[model samples]
Target: MRTTKHRLAVVTTALLAAVGVVAGPSSGATRPGDPAPPRPVTQNAVSDSFSDTYADPSVIRGKDGWWYTYATSDPLVSGGTPGLMHMARTKDWSSFEYLGTVFSDATRPTWATRTSGLWAPDVRKIGDRYVMYFTVTDSTQHPQGDDSAIGAATAPTPAGPWTATDGPVVPPRAAPGGGWWWTFDPSGFTDVDGQRYLYYGSYFGGIWVTKVADDGLTAVGEPVRVAVDNRYEGAYVVRRDGWYVLMASAANCCAGPSTGYSVFAGRSRSPMGPFVDAEGTSLDTSAVGGTIALTQNGNRFVGVGHHAVVTDSTGADFVVYHGIDRHDPWLAEPFGINRRPMLADRLDWVDGFPRARAGAGPSDTPQPGPTLGSSLGITPEDPAAGGFTGMRVGPRDRLGGATGLVRGTASTRRAAPAGDVHVRLDVRGDKPLRVTLGRAPGVTVTVDPRGRTLGMSTSGAGRPLRDSTALPRTSGWQTLTVRATDGQVRASLSEDDLHDPYAEVTLERDRLRVGSAPVRLSSGGTVVDNVVVTPAAQDARELAPVPQAGALITGEEFDDASTPALTWVRENPQARVEDGQLRWPVEGTDLTGGGNQAGLLLHDAPDDGDWIAQTKVHLDLGSDEIRNYQQAGLVAHATDDDFARLGTVAIWNTRQTEFGREVAAAPDGRTSYGGALVGTAAPTMWLRLAHHRTAEGEHLYRAGTSRDGRTWTWGATWALGAGTEPRIGLYSHGGASPAAVASFDHLRFYRTRWPSDPGAG
Candidate 1:
């Protein structure tokens, strides 16, 4: 089988070279890049930050709960003076507050005089003070390894005022047992016993560890060689589960796309002894190194290396590093390689191995923001279980796979991690408004422009309860407020009247609602600016409640930068995250060869029982109206020869057609397309495939399509004759426009009952 390509994707100029297209399940034809069963991507994918860039980053979570990132001086690129470490802070990795440089160039020590410049640096918290470890060379040589030294500086807080040692803290080792010796990049380690140590070195010399004094200004013990991973630098040590994971950067870091830089790792029982990869090859014995922690994933992040790890209040870890930009990758004059911006991704320990999302590396997809948005503002009676609390959908996107709304309310109901949910929603539209709530185990009160309406509902613990009411129809910007407390709900269309005596009503439980926009009308879906669920005893914003293990499922909205629990695999580098959607363009040569299928597959074990995979897909024809049998939607594949497909399309004879493929019995199957074609005004199709066991004991698959994410119109069902479980994939193909511009607005997988809601504009 052809191996999966998770790194750089070679753009083949041979378009026609990849021939043949599978017209339907009734045919045995296959697409290009479909030779192998793509591996699942459990990879914590990430993308460039919002208009921020930095190099050689050292990230850490301070004792104060905020995350800080310190970087080496980029005078070579930013035309700034040396000795200035750039800094930034973030509550959630999604948004950051840039704090400029840490110290002035005047803080440069006289002993360290490397003309080429200061290299990798690290920061640590020692005895309530911030201690930063850095490396510098005194010579202007080609390789700045020899004559290099690791130094230290201290400050009261992470934002230092001014403090630099007179010389290199850890100078050259005279009689060190070694293979190769070059000193740079000092990774600091605060041992379990509160003692500070450092791992420093580079190139052929090998990495060594040394204990430092309590002051962090001098080395107290002799250096010893630990790992000699080939050409590795930027040594970092992570102690977890009684194992020391040594992660370092490998390969040439700055030759543009030709740069071979990637992150490799090894583990050991003790801090200074031997560490090795899965094969038991000691990092000190072999130059090739141990297991890999991060690598290139072609979608745009290239030459991913030089990284550091930090943890959230919940102890969830994320790695920050700099990587080459696939789009504008070029050596920008004297700055070495430009566009290598700071990128990050969450890390997970699978079967004892610390891996990037699904064992993959840096991805270009927009990931979910770290859920650490706010600290608990209050204390709670029940312990917080970070479950699938709620979701925020933006304009121009589908509801993903939301199922829980029945009747008018929603099926899903969850309590505040601390208190009641106080919803303050900002909305704008001219059409009449309809809101659907799937959870209302109690009474619900609604207010519209006409009058006040009330409904009583009952939902068992974790069951579905639906409720609906007309929202006050208003044009222009306005605020809709809802506050639930003790089965009583106080809601209003105006923020000023939320708590007014007349605006108060009663609701059984807290429920989330959906709008009625078709396609992003101006700004579609619903934008949530302030969704703070309050706590009665204390604020839930300050509480750093850890997430339950089961909440880390394979459901991806392409909105957060995190590793999903399920493995997601990409077949080629043609996929990307843009405008908050997972998009795969059909450039004539897709994963389905000359046909209309290019997709990324999720390797979810079918043995996990029955499931429903759903997503929102749309084809962009620009101003040109679609004319061909444009197809795009969900694909379920068991092997190279079997699978099922469902989505929205314009066929040779229909409009927004319900198009699908059923390849159950090998080379011969059947074709199913939706009969009702949606209007072209707004063309986002919500599609789902539910796998169930029939009375005959056969695992039957049912396909459905929706104009909106809620209600579903069930379509054809096919019996399985191939593999027991199939992989879920998202594909885009065959639009009259050769661009094959199809986009998946959102994707989610559910193993339970489906909920329906009203369609949004």
Candidate 2:
């Protein structure tokens, strides 16, 4: 729903691939240009929805022991009208009672257009009063269209009878080219040294952290850019273990099912300057770096981002954010708007990194709720500090003296009762290390640094071993956690404290024996330190398997000549279908921005139900060179100005699968366009657009792309208005520079299985 900065920069493939799961390690391990290790998947984060359509939520616990939440101006229920702002509070976090809007008609700010939106509310306790900072979508001071700015308000209680300042707290920044930079998503932070700061801005101008004056209303000194533009937004900062971590949401925040909106993190020792990812890559680079914080697993929920972190009574953190259920994506009746329900999940600190649901992404299952002074029927174990007897102490010279054993050192610790146990330790060196969790016949997990691999083997015969070459490079210290639960041993290795495990492996029971077993560590040539063994809590539940695709409705072979006239309508006679292929030459025309001269070969979409439209296209616009925007693929067109296009396009140095949309701008009759990235692109890529119609007629089109045409990666969905009927089409446009042609293999349609309520836990 928040569609500002429609022309934001594109995220490069190098940045996106940083979190992607590849087959194995890079061909050249020691090469400086080697790709980062594939991140391991963590699942089973139980989440419950509190309020529907509560986008960009900010939450804080009041002195009264109730957690109060504030959300961007949106309807709280289906077919409901939006308020000035939405607020709710819950003592237990399970049930919520709406406390009504933060601003009444008489108290709402009026320095902008009468229809200006108030969004992304951030509340903090300042001095003796609670202060809230929010985004003003337009400002009379900036007159030139959507010049959003940060506005501050004050109240005595969480459910505030608030009062806004005389003017914008952080005024709109004028862009050099005209209009204003996106000064949105206002968040407040107070450094350890008692210096207050205000974090604001979006993908348009990058996320910036600025010093706050004593009043907490106006900014002082210079603003520091913590994250680069076009990649991160909704900046939230937390200070932990002498590090200032910047967490932000990436991708389109409102793209229905295609909403790949997820949270990422970077940390720096100082409150500002040089925040980097686990690989020490700066967040302000073209090849941007960010540890994956919260991403969508293949589940009912997508677009899980724009979050707020609140610590419960027991000192555990919970991430309160918004997500759209793929099945029921929109608000009830007039359903073009995305229905982003407020959700909360446990936030765990594995090492020093923040992982939502221990890196499980979003959950659709019933999970152990947050600990608020009372036990959640689960008891957390305190890890043993130090308990190991040295066997063969390693070389004292090459291996620096760390707490744990180093190369050539061997040690064993007495294990606790069977049930479930977890061993956490840090490893270093360029050699391999062996860890035996239980006993001699227990699970043996090996960490190989030079090879960038993780191997697991059980002592029992006929029990197959498992290995993963996707382990992060171990030039520095890495955290390794091995867990044994119910006869299953799982091992995960993290690159650094700021990341989730980059590699993971699980081994089933073989000659495995649990009970009063012993834990052994053999640092073959590697170094191990900070050993901690504890009882693991089996609180996480396994998620149900992802639902499979339903029946195929139609599979167009693109071979018949008369089908182009009977089944498809060519907007222009610039393309031809011959020999089971639709050949459309690359055109110099375009459909993005203010241009709309692209040719379209259209086919009427399903008139009644939800369906999927898929096409395989071969368009090679050579990479590492500027091809401008030459692209060709599938399109769901409503008009020249209203459409959703999915194409493999050459954007600057990289080729990307872009799912972009254009729609008529409200109030102003011009068209506004913005693009969200999908998966990595290949010369021949399979693209699919899954379309669903709401009861009120809005169309939701989700984008999916595959490099091999089998394993598909679905991304953010763009919503089209119900004013016109959109026809599925194929198009070729953008400057046809370094000339290329696009050949479409076929067009297929499939029926979908609609879930009654996918978000219901």
Among all candidates shown, the one with the greatest TM-score: 2
The reply for model 1, stretches above 4 Å from the true place, is 1-53, 76-83, 114-116, 139-146, 174-180, 331-336, 373-761
lDDT of 2 by residue, 249-296 (tens): 877887555566878788898778688865566777544566667766
The model with the greatest lDDT is: 2
lDDT of 1 at 40: 21
For candidate 1, the per-residue lDDT at 243 reads: 70
Candidates in order, TM-scores: namely 0.44, 0.54
List, residue by residue over 1-761, the lDDT tens digit for candidate 1: 21212232122111101210001011111223212112122222222343324678887544233567777766424343443667777655655677766655566665655353666768875544567888766532223334667777877666665477776777754336642246788987755443557889876467888887756678887778886523468888876545778888765566443343667678888778687865465666422335656655323455677888764322245678887663455434444335466777766665455565534456555453333332223111111122122333323312111211112211113333211234433333332233323222232333333333322232333333344443322233334444433323344443211111112233333222111111011112233222222221111122111111122235777774342643444354666776677767753433332233444456463454456777888764432243555567777666433455565554322243332333322112422111211112126677776765543444545565665655444433444443356777676655435556677776676664422111100
lDDT of 2 at 104: 77
Give the worst 10-residue stretch by lDDT in candidate 1. 16-25
